[model samples]
Target: MSWYNTSARQLPWRDPGTDPWAILVCEVMSQQTPIARVLPAWEEWMARWPDPTALAEASPAHVIIAWGTLGYPRRALRLQECAGVVVEKWDGTLPRSREDLLSLPGIGPYTADAIIAFAYRERTTVLDVNVRRVLARIYGEAAPPTSLKAWEVERASHLVPDDGEAASQWNAAIMELGALICTARNPRCEQCPIAPHCAWLKLGKPEAATPRKVQAFEGTHRQARGKVMRVLRTAHAPIGVEELRERSGLPEVRFEPALTTLLADGLAAATPGGIQLPIE
Candidate 1:
């Protein structure tokens, strides 16, 4: 915890007494997006809707527009849904239990655990990509951590302090270390607080035989979806089908699938004219 206080990155979500809604928003936004990109968005979002009731009352279109190029526009829809559920079912309170959090849209195991630990100060394991990487390098006997391994969660839970307050700081510290120092590429081991104890460093940092596969973005359904969303964000009213087709510059075959995904994911709405982000 002391290591983190000295080295912790000053993030808006890390502010004292941060609401669970803000924590949840940060977790969702940070998925697949870098922290640097998510910070300003988190700040702006909290400024606009600091609690579940506020976001629940707002339109999904406004949320999508405010999300602004975070990639994965569906997260905006899921976040809105999550807020609405919190308002309706939980009485505008963010649930501290992991099961309750998991029931919310856009929250998987990692996010649910994070909200419990960081927002509610519960003694729980937070196993995000950064946490996984740090633990893999430090403790993995044979291979780097792949996906969310069951053992990793057990190990992380073991590391958590018995004291709730200290444990919360410990959780945040390890995650912060992973984010700032123990990066995936070009980790600054010399400056790392835990480097001396890292098992990967103890052994040579060997390149894995099978490299991780990168998600292809260009010329894919996701790209087409982004195009459609951009058009909606810029359009003042419901855009006609012809105009959408023209603006997206995507083939009819690709456009249909992308549009279906968008609507299915709650990112867009169909109108008599065509489709648009639900007007707030």
Candidate 2:
């Protein structure tokens, strides 16, 4: 089937008229977050900020709070920073070029390409985990994409329709195919639109030798850091070291490491009383 013949889910940002700022917001929010969770947040954000200028003018603390419950609150700061750059540098516009978007704070290759293709309706290869999985399955590759290979982009670029409107639809359709059917876990292959052409399906889906790496969460320094940040994110004033120690439930030694990590990562800042979100 042609890429367009495969029906896909309709996403707000996939619409041709979606503003670049809104598309950028979706990209950041969707990082490490499921689409189900990001939709409501995106709606609220668009309703509140509407554009780069509005987000740039808002306090970082307000942005963090508004970002509500999206883990990795530091992204909020980087997003605010990105908005400021977009408004100040781009004259209140998001740059359409991939290189220019990549130059923005917190925007990496995937995000840059995503904004260009989805928001600006540019014909560019947009690769994310889902797209990678779909590509791998279609090619019957054993390994998932380790790095952004030149061929991968070229292949995706070829699939994009030459016409602007169809190209946008193809972009969204491919992504929706990846998310709903060609999933990493518990994929619903029977319902996939492109199952007939799937090389993995033809060859019998083979398991990869190495399982995907999973990050250790519990009992790690990240957990301790999260505990510390959770306390500070909720606190109205800067907290002291002693209070952080008590709240994070980490040893005195671990507390130092956690605070240091947070500070180094721009997730937290040192204060006279204790520590706080960089807002202070």
Candidate 3:
């Protein structure tokens, strides 16, 4: 906690006065995306839609365009859906309980726990990739499993402080520790606050028995989809199929499948004019 107080990055959402809606936005934007990239986008997004009411009223096209290069554009649509639900069902106030948060679109267990711990300052186990890795090293003497296990959740739950305030701070501290000092690729153990107690470090930092699988991005359908979405986001109006395909720089085979998936995902829509971002 002391380390976090002195060393943690000064993020806007960490402000004590930040509302749960803004914290929810931060949590959504941070998933699978680096904070550096999320920072500017988040600032602009908040400036445009400061609350659930504002976001709920925004067009899907506007929301997706505002999402920019966050990679998973689907999350932008889901966030807007979540905002609509918040406005209509919850009367524009974010729900406090984990179960209630889970009911919101785009919110999973991790995001729910994050909102509970970070937004409401509740005593809940908040685990992200970084926190999971740090805990695996310190307690399990190895990297986290390819998938999270029941035992990991149980252990993490058992470790949270009983008091809500302390637990929230602990969650933030551990997550920051993992991001800064206990990173997955090259941990700076010498400077880690918990290095002395880390089982992996004490055991000489043994390598995983099997190498973790890395997901390829280049030359994949995802890359093709990104190209198509970029074209849609930049277009002044609905673009013809031929123009979209040519502008995306993807071959017909790749472009067709990417467009199909984007349409199915509601990230894009087909209209009389042509293909464009979803208006609804």
Q: Write the per-residue lDDT of candidate 2 for residues 1-280, one digit (tens) a residue.
A: 2644546556787665778889889999999999889999999989999998999998776787777777777788899899899889999899988889889999998898788777887677778878878888888875576677888887767777787656766776777788877788778889887888889888888888887788888888767877887777788988888887898788888788888888887777786776777763
> Which one wins on TM-score?
3
TM-score of each: 0.94, 0.91, 0.98
Q: Name model 1 segments beyond 4 Å from true.
A: 140-143
**Candidate 3 residue lDDT tens string, 1-280:** 9999999999999999799999999999999999999999999999999999999999999999999999899999899999999999999999999889999999999999999999999899998989899999987466888888889999988889999999999999999998889988888988998887888888889998987889999999999999999999999899999999999999999999999999999999999999999998
Say which prediction, candidate 2 or candidate 3, comes out ahead on lDDT.
Answer: 3
RMSD of 2: 2.2
RMSD of each: 1.8, 2.2, 0.8
Clashes of 3: 0
Per-residue lDDT tens digits of candidate 1, residues 1-280? 6789887887777889777788888989999899889988888988998888888888888899999999998788788888889889999998888888889888888888888888888788788777778888887443455666777778778888887777778888888888888887888989998878888888877766677778788999889999999999988889887789889998999898988888887788888877989754
Q: Rate the local accuracy (lDDT) of all candidates.
A: 0.84, 0.81, 0.93
Candidate 2 backbone collisions, by pair: 239-274, 240-274
**Model 3 residue 268 CA deviation in Å:** 0.9
What TM value does model 2 have? 0.91
Residue pairs in candidate 1 whose N, alpha carbon or C atoms collide under 3 angstroms: none
